[model samples]
Target: MAWSDLLAGFAFFLMIEGLLPFVRPDAWRRGISILSEMQDGQLRRTGFIIVVAGLALLYLVRA
Candidate 1:
């Protein structure tokens, strides 16, 4: 609820987002390449699913 809590959450998110590239740059590059090759609709659906999953997790954690 506080600004500090929001900043801390973002910091954790950044650390987690960096892990794959830090640990396995090649794999991360390959994944990005595959993502780039996806069709627009496929990419949209994949993004929507990811958003929904993240929202569901946030709801569960906050609730």
Candidate 2:
């Protein structure tokens, strides 16, 4: 709820987001290319699923 908490979450997200590309740059680029070819609706649904999953995880962890 605090700024510090939000910042910490952002930092964690950055670290996690960086991991795949750091470990396998070619695979990361391939994934990005695939994503770029996806339709808008497909991308939106995928993003929505990810958001819901993240929220579910947060709820379980905080519970």
lDDT of model 2, residue 21? 100
Error of 2 at 27 (Å): 0.3
Worst 10 residues of 2 by lDDT: 54-63
- Which residue ranges in model 1 land beyond 4 Å of their true spot? none
RMSD of each: 0.8, 1.0
Model 1, 62: alpha-carbon shift in Å? 1.0
Over the stretch 16-46, how does candidate 1's per-residue lDDT look in tens digits?
9999999999999999999999999999999
**TM-score of every prediction relative to native:** 0.92, 0.89
- The regions of model 2 sitting more than 4 angstroms off are none
TM-score of 1: 0.92
Q: Residue 43: error of model 2 in Å?
A: 0.5
Q: Number of backbone collisions per candidate, in order?
A: 0, 0
Evaluate residue 43 in candidate 2 and report its C-alpha lDDT on the 0 to 100 scale: 100
